[model samples]
Target: MSTIVFAFSIFCGWLIFDVVKHRKLTLESLVSSLVIAVVAGVFWWILDLFF
Candidate 1:
């Protein structure tokens, strides 16, 4: 369940990031999406461990 949620979050995050960035494939958007995803993953992991 967590895995599925995390993957969905990443996909959603990427979509939002892509829109905000105004580019489908660029270094900045890629980095921003990755960073956001990673942060979200870590946050999810912490939540899973705690709750």
Candidate 2:
């Protein structure tokens, strides 16, 4: 749970940085990256729990 939260937070920070640097946050990139990050985080959590 902590790992997932941390991963999501890091991804969100990266997204925010990109938005600030580009002066825009495209819907596609935002949604896609968010989804990817969430899925990756979940997987990481599961793996950590098992191993």
Tens-place lDDT digits, model 1, residues 1-51: 785579568967796769766855677776777777778877888888899
Best by TM-score: 1
Any runs in candidate 2 off by more than 4 Å, and if so which? 17-23
Best by lDDT: 2
lDDT measured at residue 7 in model 1 versus the true structure, 0 to 100:
53
Task: Write model 2 residue lDDT over 1-51, tens digit each, in one string.
Answer: 688687788679868877887799898768866876787788788889899
- Against the hidden true structure, what lDDT does model 1 obtain? 0.75
Please list the residue runs of candidate 1 whose C-alpha ends up more than 4 Å from where it truly belongs after superposition: 1-12, 15-23
Residue 11 deviation, candidate 2, in Å? 3.0
RMSD of 1: 2.7
| Steric clashes per prediction | 0, 0
* lDDT for position 40 in model 1: 81
